[model samples]
Target: MKRLFRILIIGLSTLALAACSQIATDANSLFVSELTEKEDAILSIASDKSFVFDFHIDSEYKEASVWIEKYEAGKLVDDRLAHLTTEVEQSGSIIVTLSENTNENNNSFNIGVGTDENLTSINVSDTDLIGLESMASVWGSTSEKVAIDNGEAVLANISYSDDENGMHSLTTDFFEDAAGHMNELEKYDVAYLLKVEFVK
Candidate 1:
C-alpha cells in the first residue's frame, strides 16, 4: 500500500508540472497586438487627440485591465499613466483608446477599454506625474518635440497606490521582475495590458 501511494503521488506531481508548462505556453500567445505602425520609430499624433488600439485576446480571459507607461530616451518615466478594467467576452477584437489632454498648460490623459463602447474609463491628471514635459512642451508650439523609447504591452494583475499622487501607481512587489522592470507582470486570475511609446 505504501508503494502504491508513492506511485500515485509521483503521477500527480508529473501531471501538475505538465499543466504548469501548458499555461506558460498559452501565455505567450494570449494577447495579440494589431497596431498598424508598431514598427515605426516614432508615432506622431496631435496633443489633443486620441490613439486607438485594436488587439485580439484569447477566449480564456473574461476580465482584464489595460494601462500605459511613459518612457523617455530608453528609460521609464511613468508606469501608470492610465488604467482601465473591464469585462470581455469570447475570443474577439478588444479596442483600447488612449486620449491625451494638454491644454492651457494643463496635462492629462484618459484610457477607455471595451469592444464597441467605453466599458471602462480611467482618467489621470496629476502635475507631479513624470513624463509630462513632452506633452506640456507641445502645447504652445508645433516644432517642439519630445521623444521617448517605445511602447510595449504585457498581461498581469497588479496593485496600485492612490494615496501618494491622488492617482494609481504601481505599489505591488510581485508586479516587477528581478531587475525591477515593469514588464514583469504578476497574475492574480486577471489580465493587465500596458503600452509604452516615445515621441520623437
Candidate 2:
C-alpha cells in the first residue's frame, strides 16, 4: 500500500512540473529561424504581406524605439525606413506593411509602421529600387532579383529579451549583421525589438 502511494505522488509531481514548464515556454515564445547564425542572410517575403510583432514594454523602461534598415554586403544602406519613439509604456503590436507598385501613378513602395491607429511611413522610389537590385550581385542569388522585380520584400526582425540574448526573425540568419548594425537600437533597450526590412 505504501509503495502504491509513493508511485502516485511521483506521478502527480511529474505532471505538475510538466505543466509549469509548458507555461513558461509559452510565455517566453520568440521567433527563431534555422539560419539565425548565418551572416548577410535575407528572408524573401511576398509583396502585400505584413509582419506583426506583439510587444509589451515594462514601465521600468523609460522609452521605446523602433526602426527598419536595409543591408548589402553586410553594411547598412538605408536606416530611415520607419522609426518611432514612445515615452510611455507601450503594449501593442508593431506592424510593418509592404505595398507593391501596381500603377504608374505610384511607382513607389511605401513602408509603413503602425501601432494601433498611429502610423509612420517612408516612400521608396524606382531609383532606390534599382539601387537595391544592383546590390543583389554580392549575395549571388539570381532569385533575389526575381523576387525584387516581382515587388517582393525582405526584413530583418530582432527581439531582445531580458536574458540579453536577442531573438531574430527567421530570414535575418545573420547574427553578425544584426549585432553589428544595431543603428541606435542599443541606445534604447527594448524588451522586444522587431527589426523589419522591406525590399521591392
Candidate 3:
C-alpha cells in the first residue's frame, strides 16, 4: 500500500510539471510572429544603410542574447556588430545607434522597446523641409502595415504626425499583442527608430 501511494504521487507531480511547461510553450509561441517581424524590419533597414540594430532577446528557457546586423544599399554590408548575452531585466530595450561615420552630424534616433512612453523625435531645421515630410510618410505607411498584421487592437489610438519643431513624431499605444500581453520578448515599440536619414 505504501509503495502504491508513493508511485501515484510521483506520477501526479510529473504530470503537473509537464502541464506547466506546455503552458509556457504556448505563451511563448504566440510571440514568435512578432519576433519575426522585428527581424524582417531590422534586416530590411540595415540593408539600406551602414548601421547597426541591436536586438535584446528575453526568454526563461533559453539564454538571452543580442544579435547585431549591418547593412548598406539594401544589402547586409558587413557584420561589424557582435552578439552579447543579456539578463532578464535588460531584455526589453534594443538600442540601435547609428555609427558616427554614418551620421556625420551626430543626429540619431532612439526607440522605446515595449511601450511608447519614450519615443524618439527628429529635429528638422526648416518648416519647409521636404525630407521631414517624406520621412514621416514612409514611416506612417510601414508602421500601419505592421500594426494591422500584429492585430494591435488599440492601433486606432496611435498617431504618426509632425510636431511644431518641424520634426516628425509617431506616437501610439499599439505595441502589445491581441491578448493584451506585453510581449516584451519582442521590441515592437522600436519601429520608429528604423527610419533612415538621407545624406544631403
Candidate 4:
C-alpha cells in the first residue's frame, strides 16, 4: 500500500507539470509576434496649442485594443475620448467630441477615456489661445518636442500665470492628426505623449 501511494503521488506531480505547461502555451499564444512594427505607424502632432494628447495599446489572448486621454489645467477633461478593439477580421475605432465651457473670462476644455485598457491612438486639437502664441518659437526646439511626445499619460504639468487680468479674450484654432501604427501586429501595445501650450 505504501508503494501504491508513492506511485499516485508521482502521477499527480506529472499532471500538475503538464497543466502548468499548457497554461504557459496559452498565454504565449495571446501575444502578437510583431507588435512594435504596427505601433510605429502612429503619427505625432505638433504641440503648439493648449491641449495635450497621449496614446497606448495593450493585448491579451491574441486580441488587442487601444486607449487615449487628454487634460487641461492639471485636470482630466476627456474621460470617454476614444478606443479601438482589435480582432481577427477587423479592428474597431472610437471617437469622442469635445465640449466647450465659457464662463466669463475663464474658459475650459477636457478630453480622455474612463477605462484603463489599451488604446491604439489618441489625437487632441484645441484652439490656439493668445497666451500660447508667444511660445510658438519654442515648439520647434527638439527637447521641448521630445517632452511633448513623452508626456501623453501624464498631466503635462504645463501652465502660465497672468499678473494683470482684464478680459483676456482668448482665441484658438482646431488641429487634427491620426495613427494606424498597430495594424501589422497580431498582438502588441505602445504608448505616446503630446503637449501643446498657448502663449500671447
lDDT of all predictions: 0.35, 0.32, 0.26, 0.25
Top TM-score model: 2
| Candidate maximizing lDDT | 1
TM-score of each prediction:
0.37, 0.39, 0.24, 0.23
| Residue 57 displacement in candidate 3 (angstroms) | 9.8
Task: In angstroms, give how far residue 123 of model 4 lies from its true place.
Answer: 6.6
lDDT of 1 by residue, 154-173 (tens): 32222222223233323334
Q: Name model 3 segments beyond 4 Å from true.
A: 1-26, 29-60, 80-82, 89-200
Deviation of model 4 at 87, angstroms: 2.5
Pairs clashing in candidate 2? 38-174, 154-197, 155-197
Model 2 lDDT tens row, 39-132: 1111123233334333333334343344655443234556654465544222333333343343332222333333332444444443333322
How many residue-pair clashes does candidate 4 contain?
Answer: 29
Q: Please give, for residues 42-131, the per-residue lDDT of candidate 3 as tens digits.
A: 434433221222222224323233333222222333332233333322112233322112223222222212211221212111111122
- Residue pairs with colliding backbones in model 1 are 147-199, 148-198, 148-199, 150-196, 151-196, 152-196, 156-192
> What tens-digit string does per-residue lDDT give for candidate 4 at 1-200?
22332232233223333333443232111111111222222111111122222212223223333333334332445543344343311111122222222223222222222212222233333443344322211111011111212212222222333323311111111111212321211111111122222111
**lDDT of model number 1:** 0.35
- When 1 and 2 are scored with TM-score, the better candidate is 2
> Which run of 10 residues does model 2 get worst, by summed lDDT?
136-145
